[model samples]
Target: MLPTEKDAGSASMSQVSTSTERANQADVAYGRLKQLILDGTLPAGAQMLEQEAATRLEMSRTPVREAMVRLRQEGMVEIRPRHGMRVLPISASDMAEIYAVLTALEGTAAELVAQRGITPRQLAQLRGAVADMQTALERSDLKAWAAADEQFHLHLVRLSGNSRLIQMVGQLWDQAHRARMLTLQLRPTPSNSVKEHADLVDAIAAGDGPRARKVHEDHRRRAGTMLVDLLDRLGLNQL
Candidate 1:
């Protein structure tokens, strides 16, 4: 059937509006689900029911299902035959692998930033995130601290100005976030992390790439060791 001009314009607008609405819904679902997972509201190895999530988000199951699929692709969830969709459990070895990749990526990013020089606006944003992290630490807010920590790493990745690098590092960062939340929940003290992050910012501000790289690597390595130690204490070191 051929459509007249009026019909064509209306149809196009309808399609665009529908797409825009779907995109917004998906973002909302993904953000909520991701926050739930990171904040431990959705515990590791817990079942993820799409209908339940949809109900919670006040949306249809379709967007929730799509978000779960995205999370699965991000290594945040696993779909098992009998278990259905479940949050992946934290593992010491998995933490090691994630940090190893992150160390390389972030070190490279530091070098890039030093060579290219980050803009003042980017630096300001990074400092703002760090300040927020300090406030979270002072208030003993685990969720806020973790969120700020993620933003800090994300800012550095964006500074690298490499789309592929940003994407790869983001995936690793998400995995690391899960492990970090587990560790932070167990410990709940932010002294070590606070100092490490402060030193990182200092190095970056000084334009010391080598120092920044070393500091970044040390931070990841220390966190990885702590997670492994915690797992061992819990008698779950095999992970």
Candidate 2:
């Protein structure tokens, strides 16, 4: 007997549902694994097989494999043909290079945001992030401060309305996550960073493009230099 049109449609719908489910699972696996790496749960130089990672993530090996491939593309992991994945470490030199790119791209983003003139609500969000950083620092909560700091920078970049710039900077953020967290405590309190961020918000709010760009670029440069120096002085070649 020939299949009815309704039956064929059902089959097609089933295939679509299955594909969506797989993609969702793959996304879950990717987020979980990426978080593990970023938070130092799966620290640099760690190695695991696909089966082992799947077991840990409580997902199927297929989704885990897909996640590993994504991570490899982001330079967070290395996948050997039969050896599974090895977490990649960022060296001090790598951080320097990453910071250089971030400095240029993010400065441009700030300038664009200033030139475009954000809405009051957008300006409030940036100020709120800065406020969060200030409050966090007062309580000696570097972790919270770091999170807020990231929020401000990422939000500022997105305000540029440049999708490609946002994407490129996001990848860099992921790649630099471990080192930043590692050095978070090793360096002095980020009092200066909070102040600089507040200043940047003011500049953006005033629509001073050159001032916004200069302020952010100098902040990034100082941060990059301090982090590199600390890493080198402490002999932390890879993190």
Clashes per candidate (backbone, < 3 Å) = 0, 0
lDDT of 1 at 157: 80
Q: What is the Cα root-mean-square deviation between model 2 and the actual structure?
A: 1.2
lDDT assessment of candidate 1: 0.80
lDDT by residue for model 1 over 1-239, one digit each (tens)?
89999999999999999988987898889889988887778878788677777888999977777788888999888866444478887677777788778888888887677667777898888888889898998898888988898888888889988999999998887777766666677863767887787787778888888888888888877776777778777776432
Flag regions of model 1 displaced more than 4 Å.
80-84, 124-148, 185-195, 237-239
Query: In candidate 2, what are the lDDT values of residues 186-225, reduced to their tens digit?
Result: 9998879878998998999899999999999999999999
State how far residue 214 of model 2 sits from its true place (Å). 1.3
TM-scores for the candidates: 0.81, 0.96
Q: Could you tell me the TM-score of candidate 2?
A: 0.96
> Highest TM-score: which candidate?
2
**Reference-based lDDT, each prediction:** 0.80, 0.94
